[model samples]
Target: MKNLLVTQYQDFVRWLTRRLGSSDLAQDALQETFLRLEQGSSIGPVHNPKAYLLRIALNMASNRRAADNRRLATSEVDKLLDLPDDAPDPARAVEAKSEISALKRALAELPARRREIFLASWIENLPHPEIARRYQISIRTVQIELKLALEYCDSRLNRRNKLRG
Candidate 1:
């Protein structure tokens, strides 16, 4: 195998350069093929050693191409590192907190039973039928209570936004 490889090394590089479009890569692939052959890989009798050697070199080129494809280039890595973070900054964080406080105040102003039903459905993620069963009320009554609570909260938030803007 080594004798055959040495004899056809130039032919393989030329063939690979045409296939891979890079003589440098063809040389590199041939180097790896030489190293792998030196590793004493078991081989039985082969009628066509040249073809077998070409197949191994081509496979090495394919594997190197695949590995290169999966890696990020240096420019790509630098660009990604330079991108601005998505986390909210200090001013936006404070504004979000203020809005949440306003929402809590609005929810606090609801009548006791309506508040409980609203919290159960919205915060606890309880379905309407479960809320009705828990509160011993009809589904219609639960729907009405939730609607009124939502309207009251929406109005309060809208008014707050108007004042702020």
Candidate 2:
């Protein structure tokens, strides 16, 4: 299984990049696809491994886009984008930059496996069953890992905020 994943990984990524129109986003989808196999989800006798992988990647990528649209609707900036172009607020921009930096630091602090799991689950917006199958763990494990990851990063960000205030 691992051998199959290693051999065809790059090709799958390229296919995804073309489909999604972004190499960076494609790489993330690839990681999430690999994560599913890593967990042993049992797709049940895939005759064409590459095609199967592509299908999974394609599905994941589509799901991510849909999820992003859903999230965007609820986000703070969603209501503001329709407004006429105007000078951006310097304070808001600086705060956004600071928040991004803090997130990077918190991500770097995570254990390697935990970070991968977190990325595949949260950043990539993959389902728990998918993550569990890839990591060869339980859905509960994915949830637990995601919960811990969110908590750790939130704490870091909160601490940084406290310092700033």
Candidate 3:
């Protein structure tokens, strides 16, 4: 049973890693998946071990990505806090800062779930079926979210560009 699980999961991890576009993250997610399996954690079943593992991996990756984004946002805020109140050319700096703020605001305005689907599909390059499975939704839903996200991003960018012009 152990050997079979190892072989099956290892192959699935390899495939998932490729799908996820990050070998290091894949390794981490794969290990977590197996740990959950070994502990008898109720994450579906072993009938389609590959699909189950992929789902686990996708969830883990999404979580890690969110944590990373939070850290980055925190750091950016800290940097802004450290800026000198009496800096030279404050107006120019303020304008530049406003642009960054606008972009961040635009991203934050997107629906959380749609943002996740967008990032996973475009940034992570995960396939629709795999993302759908990971989120326990249909592929059609993934397609719809991705479409909405793209439209949102496009419009936001266009507006920002117009403002700059």
Candidate 4:
């Protein structure tokens, strides 16, 4: 099984890419299929190895497509854009700006390390592992710093909100 996959990997990827319309998704499916084959239990005699591998890859692609479809439709964003504008009123806009300024101040008050970690994780959408690797700290430390930073900012914002109320 492994030998067949290795020999025909490119062909499989190309076939899947054409069917799936995404080379990246094709690569992912093939990689997953290979991993599964490695850990797969003993297989009985196969009549056609290439057919078997293609079936597995196709099944994986189908499953991935179904899972992705369940998450969100590609047209959802377009539908949102077609919606009527619901612009904020002057008072609401002013209030929102004030809240944003307060949040900025709260963020600025955080320790440099904590602030950087928070921004990297949320604003930059970085994975915790990458952030930890960059900071030369454990993932756990990254999580802790993020948690503390969030708590501090939330408290500051909540306090400000209460004052306005």
lDDT of each: 0.89, 0.80, 0.75, 0.88
Top lDDT model: 1
Q: Give the least accurate 10-residue stretch of model 4, judged by summed lDDT.
A: 156-165
Return whichever of 1 and 3 wins on TM-score.
Answer: 1
| Per-residue lDDT of candidate 3, residues 1-165 (tens digit) | 334447776676678678888888877877776676688645444686556567877887888778877675777889999988776497889987976776667668899988888879867999999999989999999988877776666577665334323
The alpha-carbon deviation from the true structure for residue 137 of candidate 3, after best TM-score superposition, in angstroms, is 71
Clashing pairs in 4: none
Q: What does the lDDT read for residue 14 in candidate 2?
A: 79
Q: Judged by lDDT against the true structure, how good is candidate 1?
A: 0.89
Per-candidate TM vs. native?
0.71, 0.44, 0.40, 0.45
What would the per-residue lDDT of candidate 1 be over residues 1-165, giving only the tens digit for each residue?
Answer: 887788888998999899889999898888888989999978888899888887888889999999999999999999999999999999999998998898899999999999999999989999999999999999999999988888888798875334223
Return whichever of 3 and 4 wins on TM-score: 4
Ranking of all predicted structures according to TM-score, beginning with the best and ending with the worst:
1, 4, 2, 3
Instruction: Name model 3 segments beyond 4 Å from true.
Output: 1-5, 42-46, 73-78, 85-165
- Write out the backbone clash pairs for model 2: 35-134, 36-134, 38-134, 39-133, 39-134, 39-135, 39-136
